[model samples]
Target: MIATSVEQLLNNLEGTVQVKADRVSVIDSRSLQLKVDSIVYNAVFAEGLVRDTARWLLWELGQQLGIYPSSIHEFYMAAGRGELPKSCTVPAINVRAMNFNTSRAVFRAANELSVGALIFEIARSEMGYTDQRPTEYVSSILGAAIKEGFRGPLFIQGDHFQVSAKGFAADPGAEVNAVKDLITESISAGFYNIDIDTSTLVDLSFDSLDDQQRNNYRVCADITRFVRQIEPEGITISLGGEIGEVGGHNSTVPELHAFMRGYNYKIGDLQG
Candidate 1:
């Protein structure tokens, strides 16, 4: 059942349709067939009634944070086209929560500030609802945005789409397929930015740096191709690659060169 506050909040927001919330054992959120700005989003609330005042606070906060939906490709294209104003800066806020307190803060701040051209993303490793799968990350963000009365640019990003070395070594096929599946689902969920992190596969023991980044670049290229193939028409997803593992060694120019060379060779031609 939908909470009274949440129900009331949705009633105030335009473009909400068939808003539904059911009490369950855990927490989560999803978008329904609701349409706004030619994009569809449905709002689903978690189990148990949430009477949190943040719902109202978020709604109020949205007035200041106008929606700034943009993809990673948009940023790059602007820079490439030299359309960016001199000394322009973009603030990316990390909304690490799905339905809890942290997300509430993000909604409040973004809405209150009326910030433009902001980015919202969560790394694959830091997600809270691990059981819900990665795609739900976007759904929850949409739900939160709807709760806050946001109706503009909402850029969902897949930060650190990664492969674990141990997992890969044990079952390369499964691990590779899993990453591919994530790209598919993330794109379907309207995630416009994907960071392919195969740094864990970097074979530092290899005598040649090029050899070390073979796995990293190859996998990144594979995923990039997959993303390119399935991406919605007229839009290019921002794709990023990591050359060095975090907490290990700092990345160097050689590693970057090796990765880009391999990636270009694998994907054939880079579009935009």
Candidate 2:
């Protein structure tokens, strides 16, 4: 989508501006309750300001600062008393972010100290997601990785956030609520993608007359609809429905297709 050559589009944020957390002073000279001097810029890729200007920033950063989140994942967060979108720069995707290796080489040459002109690609580290620890692991990794990159494109993935037996055993509704909270925090942390894996709850034993499995299936369908209904625009977020085992050895193509068709999702649904 960039009109100019990739070589000429490396921008560095470190040189143009500096970020000082201690200098975070919320100015409110207005007589009103809120700060009347609020000004939101379109620089989504800037260090601290929350905006939806990633691609242009990516172009500018690559042209100026030299690094950007690879996926353009739109960000989300819960501020004050409500759930809100913090930044819309990053986009969302349906497929797993790690699946990029299937299309291109996972490794790329890095020049962390080139100091001026350079290039880079999406460098992702798994956020250590098991059923135990939550979103912070991945958020920390993403933040660190973004700082590690010299230029071009650098990004972090929220990987997969799902319902775990351990988390849910405490309470079914609690697991859902916790997952939502994690998602909110991760989006605020500047992760490019949020993979909501509800596949674990689906009842594969639907062939049987099990009520529990049937309930689980309903939950998966419900969650799928929720994601499609609420995800931010241009944020490449993917809601992977439970269409049989995604990592099983015995699931055949026909079975997978049938499972997907049953849920109204196609066999070869292509999403970026």
Candidate 3:
């Protein structure tokens, strides 16, 4: 953790800095703040390079307040139960690049500007790019929210918790354990929404439809069980699964049904 004061951190944002996209130099924090206050910041926030640094600064400031990350499951459950109003969508932001900038923008907009669940996510590969451990990602997001004085619920998600078939085939134990470790580490970091991507595990060599889906659904079910076992009571983390790899093949209704059947058999009744 950095020993600098929030004021110091915020001050650091000041002064001339180069933005690579257009080679436009931000004059200082006040100038950048005004830019952020504009709609153009939305576009700027989408840029990976600029967004990462902006969030790093805000996160450093936010950590001082000791804020904890919120769960996305509650929001989804509320929406499903018709508690949330129609036409409501929460912004689930990828924190790898734009964590700080977009976070402060959302918080400021919601509290000050009449704007914007503000979900922060870090995928498995993203952990490497940003060199952020799961705990670090959680802390940074909560910290950024705290700095903005945004008291709304904060959702930190583990996006694309996946397994590649080649890797799994090489060493099934290692591959499965990698996913499990991610689940454990992410939960420890307060991630409540996990996307289990075992789509690559599909075995097309099998003639039976159910056989083709066996690996994907079974693996998803096993991981889901693991998540359920550790999840806090009254808080079911929102879980998701895919039927197939994105570029590999189109998913059919039969495949979907087969997956659900296998998943249910392994994990038990969804309603129960």
Name the candidate that leads on TM-score.
1
Task: Identify the runs in model 1 with alpha carbons over 4 angstroms from their true place.
Answer: 1-70, 98-101, 128-135
Model 1, range 1-272, lDDT digits (tens) per residue? Answer: 34355545445333433233421111111222132211212223433233233222232233334433347777767877889886766666666644333444566677798855666766667663454344445545644565455557776677788888999999988997888887787676567888888889999888998899899888877778778888888878888888898787688897899888887888886652
Per-prediction TM-score, please? 0.71, 0.44, 0.70
What is the per-residue lDDT of model 3 for residues 1-272, given as tens digits with 9 covering 90 to 100? 23134333334444533434423343453343443332223212323533444444333333333344556766677899999889888776686865556566667777775544566777787887877677556644554455466654567788888887888999987998899899888887678788898988988889988999999998898889888888777778878888888786788999999999888888876521
lDDT of 1 at 136: 44
lDDT of model 2 at residue 250? 54
Residue 264, model 2, lDDT: 46
Kindly report which residue stretches of model 3 are placed more than 4 angstroms away from their true locations once superposed.
Answer: 1-67, 110-116, 269-272
Pairs that collide in candidate 1 are: 24-47, 31-42, 32-42, 32-43, 61-111, 64-114, 65-111, 65-114, 69-153, 69-154
RMSD of each: 8.2, 15.4, 9.5
List, residue by residue over 31-147, the lDDT tens digit for candidate 2. Answer: 111211111111211222222222233233223333344443222232322454453133322222332221112212234323221212121123332221222233222222233
Quote the lDDT for 45 in model 1.
44
Error of 3 at 143 (Å): 1.8
By descending TM-score, how would the candidates be arranged? 1, 3, 2
* lDDT top scorer: 3
| Candidate 2: regions farther than 4 A off | 1-66, 70-149, 166-170, 208-217, 224-233, 241-249, 265-272
Q: Name the Cα RMSD for model 2.
A: 15.4
